[model samples]
Target: MEITNLETLPGKQIIAHFGLVSGSTVRAKHFGKDFLAGLKNIVGGELKSYTDLLNEARDEAINRMLNQAKSKGANAVINVRFSTSSVAQGASEIYCYGTAVKVS
Candidate 1:
């Protein structure tokens, strides 16, 4: 399915709109990675482990959002957006949302 962050899909007509759809996932930091991250913090550098974890979580959330859109008979999703929140001391929730639409 096609997806875009703009208000509308460029060069495509939105024939039908399916209102709002969302997907979310909660992820916790791995113990080993957390330990490594603590060490990295002491040295002052990028925490690649945390970065990789977040990226993977985001992708999973997006895939779930796309699946929702597809289930709704939508060929695309518009004005896509992502948000994150700390759900627990060691975990965070990744959220993805968009307007599902049929486009041509």
Candidate 2:
């Protein structure tokens, strides 16, 4: 499925609105990574662990959102957005949402 953060696709027209579709995942910090991250913080540089975690979360969320759009017979998803929130002391929720639409 095509997904864009814009309200509309560049060349396609929205033929039908399939309503909202969303996907979410909650991820917790790995114990080993947390320890490494603390050490990295002391060194004052990029935290690769957190970066990888968020990247994975984003991809998972997108995959789920696309699956939902496909299930709804949507050719595309417009106005796509991502949100994150703390679900627990070490876990975070990643959500992907968009308006599913049939396009031509």
Score candidate 2 by lDDT.
0.91
Candidate 1: residue pairs that collide: none
Pairs of residues clashing in candidate 2: none
Displacement of the residue 38 alpha carbon in candidate 1, Å: 0.6
Worst 10 residues of 2 by lDDT: 40-49
What are the per-residue Cα lDDT tens digits for candidate 1 across 46-95? 88988888998999999999999999999999999999999998798999
lDDT of 2 at 25: 94
Best by TM-score: 1
**Candidate 1 wrongly placed segments (more than 4 Å):** none
Residue-level lDDT tens digits of model 2 in 1-104 = 78899999989989999999999999888799999988888789898888889899899999899999999999999999889999888688999999999998
- Residue 12's lDDT within candidate 1 is 93
Give each model a TM-score.
0.96, 0.94
Clashes of each: 0, 0
Candidate 1 lDDT (Cα, 0 to 1): 0.92
RMSD values for the candidates in order, in angstroms, are 0.8, 0.9
